[model samples]
Target: MKVTVFYSSDATKSAAFDVQPSDTVKSVKQKVIALHSPPDWANTALLAEKDSTEYFDNRKRLAQCGVVDGAVLKFTYARNLTLMEKVELNVQGTDTGNFQLPPMSISTLPPKVAAY
Candidate 1:
């Protein structure tokens, strides 16, 4: 089956790949980086447009994540900056940091956090 990964920022830019349903999301991302890496490719992630319910674990299979053949996955990266990041960028002579947070949403506390 063939899958195309498109840049979340620009749909016009995308890359297609021939992969099996069992292929891991990590492999797809690696393929993009290896064959046609987008800008700032390091530490990038592949997000499923159809299912953004939970975090896409690196080991998760494309089929498990609802990424079927012909499905277009969003090639996304962290966009917003944290408070410290904003400050660092504004402060003169400060070197830019390379840290990038993953996309997240407010949800019920985890078992550990809820217990606490």
Candidate 2:
């Protein structure tokens, strides 16, 4: 079974992996981390269905979690800031006790405009 995984911090960033029904959520997360190579600070990754409140347990198998082939799973990295967020923080000099901005969705972006 093949599943598409998207990073919650950046929906535009996603990866596809060929997984087995018997594969555990932890195994799937390993594959995604290997492929995407997200920041080292990323401690935990949670796999959830898009627009769904339920999340798969790392100890449970894909089949047990009701995951099927061609399913879209959103990967959320909890307890750490994303690479882009880190860069922004550095640029803003947050370490210097300067202004701090609230955490927001990195996936949201303004619509593109075409140039003549």
Candidate 3:
């Protein structure tokens, strides 16, 4: 069975994966971490999907969620801020109350820093 994994930093960021049925979310995450090898300070959020809906970590098991063959899985890390974005957000005079950031460009590329 093939499962997909998707993850992002801002809730909107996402990626797809094709993996084995036997792989747990944790296991797949380990593989993804190995494959991506992100930096220590990055924030990564993991998510699983079945059909169109997303999975919550509290109730489901990666394997028992019927992540059968050819399933598309998604994981995301929303809080992983780039240096520029981080600086912008942290500015002392920044109008954080009304601040709105532009939409992030979601990509298939793996994260450079691992946001745990």
Highest TM-score among the candidates is held by which one? 2
**lDDT for model 1:** 0.69
Q: Could you list the CA RMSD of all candidates, in the order they appear?
A: 12.0, 15.9, 15.9
Error of 1 at 59 (Å): 0.6
On residues 5-87, what C-alpha lDDT tens digit does candidate 3 reach at each position? 54434455434556654556666666666545555665765556634545545344556766666666665444555655654
- Each model's lDDT comes to 0.69, 0.80, 0.57
Stretches of model 2 off by over 4 angstroms after superposition: 80-116
- lDDT of residue 20 for candidate 2: 97
TM-score of each: 0.56, 0.61, 0.43
List of clashing residue pairs for candidate 1: none
Q: Output the lDDT of residue 66, model 3.
A: 65
Ranked candidates, highest TM-score first: 2, 1, 3
Winner on lDDT between 1 and 3 is 1
